[model samples]
Target: MEPTVASRPDPTGLNRRALLQGGIFAGLGALVATAPFFADSPAAAAAAPGGPEPSAARLKLTKFKDPLRIPPVLRPRGQGGHDELTVRLRTADVTLHSELPPVTMWTYEGVYPGPTIETVSGRPLRVAWENHLTGNIPVTAVDFSLATGPSPDPLSNYPGTDGCQEVPGVAGLPPWAAVHLHGMLTGGGNDGWMENLIGPGDVQLSAYPNKQAATTLWYHDHTHHVSRYSVYAGLAGLFISRNAEERALNLPKGEHEVPLILSDRNFGLDASGALTGRSVHKVEMVGAQRLMRPHHGPYTLVNGVVWPYLEVEPRWYRFRIANTANSRIYRLMLLADGRPVPGAFQVIGSDQGLIDKPVAVDGALNLSPGERAEVLVNFGAFRGQALKLVNTFQGVTPGASNQRNDLAEPDVMQFRVADRKPVTRFALPPVISPTFKRVTPEDLPHDHPHRWVVLVGPGSANLPELWEMEEIDPAGITFPSAGIVQVQDAQGAVKTLRRTAMSYDEGRAFTAAHDGVETWKYLNLAAAPHPMHIHLAHFQVLSRENYDVTGFDRVTRGSARPIAFKAASVLEAHELGEKDVIRVGTAGQIVPGPNGTPGELVTVAVRFPVVGRGVHHCHMLEHEQHMMRPLVVSPAAHLHRGGAGGHH
Candidate 1:
């Protein structure tokens, strides 16, 4: 039987008495311990030809031993006025598993979470990113048909026809390399265009003003259609912008601050016992043909180490946690002896910068892919106790019902609190970055555009192949894809938008007036949640609305019925702060509407202060490679100029 999307938990069905008695969170440990383990089967081997087979014997649960690896800081190597930094992209062997050999990985400066680029907020940091990798690309297990380019008819078996494949004599092609400063407000050329890739021996120089506020940003490979594979092979790093205001607060500093960059990978060994990256794809038999599906890995790694341990002092320590996983949602919590520690985490900052006030959270902190959280954990009370950083959401792929039990992915990293003070030089502040001004509904202009961004995926339920392109006009207005948009009239009957495919270049997706705040309603039409991210500027979520999904799928397939949209609650505490990436729930997961099951709708207000070109789309690198759309934030003065391609 085909798997159905899990419905949202009914609030009225929850037992308040049991939760108050600590039965809910306490029962989680028992459930994980008693969960069943499934070994590899014959059918599983048939699905992935080169991927790692899921076996019960490969489970490394509770195997925390080695010390956590801290990435080295990449300081500028020039005089005060001008700062110069250079990095080389080369292949390095990294040992992820104790039993397995070191895996050959593509990294920047020969490190997984490559050297951290630390710079001041306003300092000018210019980087010369060099590509030194030669010969065949390290990752081999990929479906070329899923390339970001337009797909050919099913009858044609043309290789390299997809947007990302290599074509003979195509100047400056693979061994391609590019860097995208995620969450950095920079110019268009330095924004890392997927089309502007450099080959081996070529160096791409980017000048970052570091004008944005101090925060934990990241840099990763955004090289054309193969980014999903390049990043999987380890070409990513952390970029931190430090400022004086953040320093005066006296929050954890120096040794007390730790950067926890999280990611997951699957490894396979070759003849010489050398480890190689493995890619997994689900195979489904559609009639007599086979189709490949996208999936997530089984092993989780923190700072390039698999289930590592950290020795910590019994004091307040600040942890900058980043979820670098390709497609996993982690509800992270600090567990002491398999039970949660009350009031352990004090969330002080987020992706953009520090919040107005520190939020004391005692429960799991939900984080999707590409999301970052600056949290303070006071180990002062847990002296000599072993605390485990655990993830509660357990699912291998999208749309699968989440098993709260974490038997398979229980511990992220273990922290052994010291019995004595290692040196208490820093203390937690009552308030952090108190000067942050939140952009509210009242702050937006009355002329803000009410735009709708509909997330589309593969129409077939049997395959995980996503819809490769979005409907965009040459003039930069994205229309809903045919069969995806439905309208209700006065007669109370649903009508579908006329299905028409229009050819548009990669750059033309959306046109937003410069310095103008716009409200965008992101409606997920797919069967799973996507982390929608906007480049160039941060955005504030206005509210959430519920819309019909069961009717949407049917309407997109020619079945139309009346549909009604309902208003949901405001943003949650964690979501109230400024964020560049937001997790949007799919259409079939919410409560059923008059038409049928509805998807969740998130409305966010955004404004681009700088006039330039940039793109905004899903942060899920897998989906972004093929399904993301671009944005042209034109200056107010540029609107009076030419229509298409005016920014250039």
Candidate 2:
């Protein structure tokens, strides 16, 4: 088959809305118009023609027949000594809809979610990530323009292609692979540097020290410029780092504890149950270039099954919930037969691990992409009730509504309460891990460095600048795409923050001292809130402050009228634990286009536990592809501390 490319439209008399409506390409437009991709699927049939139509009623009312598939737990290879494992990246076919044919997917070990890797803290392991993928991308619909790039690095040495030119599939790029253990503090070589791409037949070996607290970490593809598509094709999984302290808590285990990997997927299938070679791509007219913005699917998948149901005994159950969606934000709540169940949810842990105590969730649990919430629900009271986990946030498109407040995309999964057994072993203590220590500003050393992280928006008048930060090879890399924002200090000095200039320039942006506490003030300048993700170590949120956005622009210009600042609410219960991902601002509340949320600021205290190099980027995979930059921990700054957050 010949490679397909979208023909750019003439911009003479076009407006952004007109372009979004129909300017991608005559072929793509025809396919979208004629395709009833989700019409046959019950979960997505109620969505509007253009996009997801938020429907609380539809979610609360619909009942699914397929039971939820729980991902199998993958334990370490060896019991005691150094463990060695091999994770193969390859292609497989998965069934999303019961009636539809299996959709061809790129996955780790051929499973939709790969497998849940369970390990212990202090038990280190090594993995040889092998890439065994080749041939054309199976999906028919793609914005191939965004996937291609210049020459790839020799380190990413794929078998046969020259990096200098475009290849086939999405973005005319070959399938390159890199594995990132999202929240692990391993060596610089193991942190899944975005520039380190491995292609077909290549093997990349990395180590995990497992030195951090017992928390839920994840692994996924981080290949330069292709992370969004790669992960979308299913190269992601959960890694549970446990320890004696956590095991002693005696929480639900063996069929009682579950890992709920949540995500939104837009899939099209042909009659043969294969993913229709086409995808749901949304285009935007930015400046003179038309860019394909991130796509949000109408269907929600739990453990890779669409709108599935799970049988649960009428007792307390522990759920480790992770939202892996590319862009969807979930305001998760539980409903019974179309009505909201009040005070039914309790959170025992945040991203890093078990909190000092359990906090009752008064309303829905709000989780963004890459955020995790460990929740407990007691069905002891309603043994026979049918409850549905639902999402109410309706920002399917950025800065836009779901049309008429219609609940078009809220259904998650269903839970049918089963008969209670004679004995109930587990119980929720009013306080959990009571001795859990909380970090205070006074605990920070006097000489700790205070850093500034600013999240910016797309650049004005530069459409090509919106694509992924180029790969490392000088022959393939582009210096400046779009500058997300400028990082500044109290003295009014500014540094433009963009992708790394060179692949190997580890200290391009900033470096952290080992074992030193750094106060990171994240100024959210983008219109949408970004889930700022820091690798290597988890951090504590200090405080959030809102500024007079309009006045701040002038303040930066030397019009010193003292920009008014407002301290927001105190840290909530769920946010008090160690965290690696936090939404820096209120999503969808800021102005649209290349403007930053000059008024919002989120401050966090981060301590680099291990000496390594990693990249800190927005967790929204689409944004990260275009904006992530390198962060390094110098070996010279190594200091022996008690442990990361005193876990030792």
Candidate 3:
């Protein structure tokens, strides 16, 4: 059978009495002892391959009872030429909701979602990220035994086999962290290398040149193996870069602007069946492999508050939204008086910066992990009426029935339009970014560099792997394994390719010439969708095409064949803007066969203006820790063969 996407528990189907009788919610120890019971249950059998889905009983929490929190903007101590500040990663007890007790979390600057740091374009900023966290991870569900080990049977209760050992410097050591500024262009040394970890009392100083355009960026923990846990524990913050051009547009400013940092989380239950308030990291078995699925919780946090409500004046407001979830993809839509409100907001910017013109959001706006969007919403017409920000995303579990789970919480937040007069009246300009230019294939130099990166999966332990591919002549090539694929180019010419580096430590597989543009084609051959993120540069999505995957046999042969390319019109209008992350692979589709499934090919055009080493991988924190690769950028004259391009 083929590997399936991880399935979430049906919140309504959870038997509270049965769980109590089985000692599942008795305590953390009892929960572990009762793992086999759930593994054999129908719920476990239906489990898929994404992230962990805990019981609704454990994730119980009230929604929309508390006011939303707008993180305070950090004030730089220095000004003019360069700005500097200090951010500390420490543990604190935070009140996530009004009814629930304070939850202990590892935070940046002692708060969840941290404090927002603002900067100016062309200016420079420096930060000292201090690691003040001490003790084991805050999440109760962290299983270090599964960190580095062979696959374990779902029916067994043993933590692992005799060969199962913990990852050194992570399992038993004090908490460590490495911070990465997502969507920021900087050198690798300052880009937060995964393995360059810092322990308690240690600080990792980073400098940002701020040469790029004003955009929405965020910083989070990037430690090699523990990033998933650290980020879930709340070590994340917003970094906004501003420019004169954006200011001249007269967009909403000061009190009219808000930052919406979205995240989802599940709370644990204690022996008394009371909410523990601490976050939980649950794992499950998929086939013969023990997998740590991406976490999706019952509670939706907007700016660190669960299902919060934000009061909006009767005026146009700018909302900078960032999806900081560990895995969940939010399909957001605004509703007034319980009816869909189309064209209620206009998207002005994407991951990198403002697009050429504002794209009116006709319906729902899809935001995957690590992606950001800036929009302008006018609440003038809805004065005295309440609006709801809801998620219409129904997750997909390949090879399973496609149905919306009623128990899934769709309500994200409530927007209460106060019956107040507008502070000022202003109209949106026709063009928000006059300097913005669209990038096209024709603009590239002749014979521009190109690289094929494929997302492969279910390799050893049912986990996905990223492959840096190189094409070879098909004259004498024979199908040997599943990693090999045959792709048809634009002219209908077929080419054979195979996987190169499969892990982060394998070696650097991609190299780009400084000041030159390269087209990177990402082919996803996995059952789940991957939001691929590239560091040190922003890229434009050229196109997305669907390919046939029914021929590829994972057990016996490699038989992937590219079908006639079809444009994916589902790409949103705002997506045309430059981005640092792009979603690829099978999105929301049930697997048609047991051995193979359809795939998606996403092509992007990236220009390497900064020369240094950097990494790229799925923004899904779990996938990134396991399936990431490194790349280097240097001058064209110094580029040599036998690296990423040598295979051809």
lDDT of 3 at 339: 70
In angstroms, the error of model 1 at 317 is 1.1
TM-score of each: 0.75, 0.74, 0.82
Off by over 4 Å in 3: 1-59, 142-173, 394-407, 420-424, 480-482, 489-491, 567-570, 586-597, 640-648
Kindly give the stretch of ten consecutive residues in candidate 2 with the minimal lDDT sum: 27-36
Indicate the TM-score of model 1: 0.75
- Which ranges in model 2 have alpha carbons more than 4 Å from their true place? 1-63, 139-172, 269-293, 394-407, 419-424, 461-507, 552-563, 587-598, 637-648
Give the number of the best model, judged by TM-score. 3
lDDT of 1 by residue, 263-287 (tens): 8654443465443433222111223
Q: Please, what is the whole-model Cα lDDT of each candidate in the order they appear?
A: 0.61, 0.61, 0.70
Q: Which stretches of candidate 1 lie over 4 Å from their true place?
A: 1-56, 60-62, 78-80, 140-174, 269-294, 394-407, 421-427, 460-481, 484-508, 555-563, 570-572, 586-598, 642-648
Residues 140-200 of candidate 2: C-alpha lDDT, one tens digit per residue: 2332222342112221111111122323357444678889987777878888887888889
Position 15, candidate 1: lDDT: 30
